[model samples]
Target: MSETSDAAKAAQSVEAEYASAEQPPALDTDAEDVGLMAVPATAAGLPATAQGHFAVVNANGTLARGFGVVSSSRLALGQYQVIFIQPVTRSAYTATIGLTGSVGASPPGEIAVVGRAGNANGVFVQTWNSAGAPADRAFHLHVSS
Candidate 1:
């Protein structure tokens, strides 16, 4: 058989196999499926149990878009850490991080710089007061409702 005819026969065989194969079920948002999951409703300012949350807030308390998480349940009464993967440009002394969302009538949770590295010293320090301007730092937050 000629190469052209052989190629056509191969293509036809492949197409026939695909045509006889069962198709995948349609995506159902209401139900969970492979590679898909439902997002549970959660209170504001709480991270989802399944996924971590991310945000970028300015010194003036301005939060960038795509900030926050969806938790399946309310945040427990405990401490949570906000690690800065990409530390802000502002000095840690001047930088402040806090949580904002529906936390009943009480004020939002308070977060302070608990651990950080000094830009000049390059040494990790445990500080309660906000200080330094490290490139990467994390804050420890106390959440109480």
Candidate 2:
């Protein structure tokens, strides 16, 4: 009886192994880049015909997924570019970029931007200026990079 149970378990294990072997190997979702978020900043001091800029404050040096907007009310996934224009406002609200992956852990490293701005816990800021204040703009993060 005990031998029969052991055989059954062995058979099940073999079946699972076969099933997995038949399918393509799973991707390495454990990669540090996955889901990312972006927020809007102000466009103050820029000329009426000027475009603003965007900035990111990465406190933990995590690799953000991506950045963009949603047309619908649902918080669905969307893709945003690395640049945008912002409204003319005095105060600016720094956006937060969150990173998620397989283990869902933030990568331990310094922050960098398009071959510039390399520092830990620093702000990756991009702006369009018309003189005194900068124009408002939107931006997205790069993860697969």
Candidate 3:
């Protein structure tokens, strides 16, 4: 038992098992259900829970949910309307509206429905054959479920 005192008692039992090791639990940002969950404004149809920009598809087999709105200002053409904080629960019938970013002219296909079907929010835009009647736009409206 004297090989340098048995290697100093096996290095003090491996430093007491690395000082009793046992740590991993330090992240409790005040814990009380921590964040984002209050979706209720008449929650209905395919993932409708009252937020914004949503999509939950699986069509042919059922289960669909897609709601949206992305907007920009400045228009001078015939129609250009908007609205939709969160309102697209039932009848949207594959709704869609387009035109995006830096588009100055000649970019406004069409989409003029989804105004109140089962409580939609709003929509309407123009331009397609109107060529480039009035510019400055960026719109994207969507609906499903």
Candidate 4:
């Protein structure tokens, strides 16, 4: 067959398989703005951590996008576009939990959190030790609730 005809046949085959598939792949939650996307747990389970090229601010109790951890002591990053989607209430507090990367590609890294803005008026962005450690650690946090 001609190249064009061959390619058309392959495309049709792919489409047929997709149409008959049970479900699509679950999207990576860590890559979306907080309010714009709501990612439920997949077969792998809910995103236990956010791991991406972007920094994510997971609201308290909400899973961090893009990254997750096999254990609390370590984390892996993912890719997500993060933003402050909603504002907290007067009686509520906003917490910023940050997970830092390892030194020279090592595991068993460190994490830091900063809580500030009077429980309802703070914004945060994640940082790393290369940014400068606050108290001799790889990460630091300032929180006020």
Candidate 5:
């Protein structure tokens, strides 16, 4: 048989097989599959620590968007302070180098997070280049307790 005719026969076979295939149980797969995922019925058995606050800060320490964040400040160069509406002194602090927008990858750097010395609601963040010198870099902060 000619190549064109042979290709046409294969295409028709595929079409017939697909037409005989069964449809999934649901049309909206994401919504239907969500019910199959394991979700805790309650938080009673989980660890006490839970994400309570988060913030995305610009290199200049401007608040981008966040939950329970009051304000953000660029203290000096790579140092920043993020304040939340509630006290977070006892919460676990975490930070990572990031950008205020999702357009590009953030500069590779090191970040550290800690509770502010005198402010119960403040978190201290510091970013440093790979060489360890402080440098201005946007970051994301998370607080859990």
Candidate 6:
């Protein structure tokens, strides 16, 4: 009879493979820039004054997925801006600590949102750890006019 691989043997094989592996790429947790993000053409037609739009932002200020969102940028530690295709000045904003991908629970943190200075179609977002220091966090943002 043929025998299946044992768990210990499989683990040893994996460890052997890892011994020759190169260093993994750096994580994006605190990346200064993720470069220019590609926005879908559909986002352009979205009215700047549209309501009920939302964005899922990654820890590095990249847009995971969003409706009526054009782009995102990391301005400073724990400070980011979400740019919309339409104006959000008359809209109410809400943000929550969350993940950009399917990864489980997010780290506990505080989030705040406000209108971007000198920009009507932008919203500034800030994140902080439980200790109230600047922190990188994934989040979801919603806007309702």
- List CA RMSD, all candidates: 15.6, 19.1, 15.3, 16.9, 8.6, 15.3
Q: Identify the runs in model 3 with alpha carbons over 4 angstroms from their true place.
A: 1-26, 33-48, 51-78, 82-120, 123-133, 136-138, 142-145
Once fitted onto the true fold, the runs of candidate 2 whose alpha carbons sit more than 4 angstroms away are: 1-81, 88-97, 100-103, 110-145
Best by TM-score: 5
What TM-score would every model get versus the actual structure? Answer: 0.24, 0.18, 0.23, 0.20, 0.65, 0.65
Ranking by TM-score: 5, 6, 1, 3, 4, 2
Model 2 lDDT tens row, 1-145: 6999999999999999998886666567634333332224346553444343433322322223323211111111221123222222232334433333344544323222332133222223333323423323223342221
Candidate 5 lDDT, tens digit per residue, 1-145? 8999999999999999989998766668778888787465445554344546799999998999999899999999899999999889878888888888979988999999889889999999999998999999999898887
Q: What is the lDDT of candidate 2?
A: 0.34
Model 6, range 1-145, lDDT digits (tens) per residue? 2245577778889999999999888888535354444233346664454467899999999899998899998889999999998889988999999998886889999999999999999999999999999999999999888
Report the Cα lDDT for candidate 6: 0.88
Off by over 4 Å in 1: 23-51, 56-61, 64-145
The residue pairs that clash in candidate 3, if any, are none
- In model 5, the Cα lDDT at residue 48 comes to 46
Local distance difference test values of all predictions, in order: 0.35, 0.34, 0.42, 0.35, 0.88, 0.88
- Predicted candidate 4 versus true structure: per-residue lDDT over 25-112, tens digit per residue: 6567744566466556556674543221222333222233322211111122311112232332222222233434333432222344
Worst 10 residues of 1 by lDDT: 69-78
Write down the worst ten-residue block by lDDT for model 5.
41-50
Is 2 or 4 the stronger prediction by lDDT? 4
Pairwise lDDT winner, candidates 2 and 6 = 6
Model 4 alpha-carbon drift over 4 Å, by segment: 28-145
lDDT: worst 10-residue window of model 6: 32-41
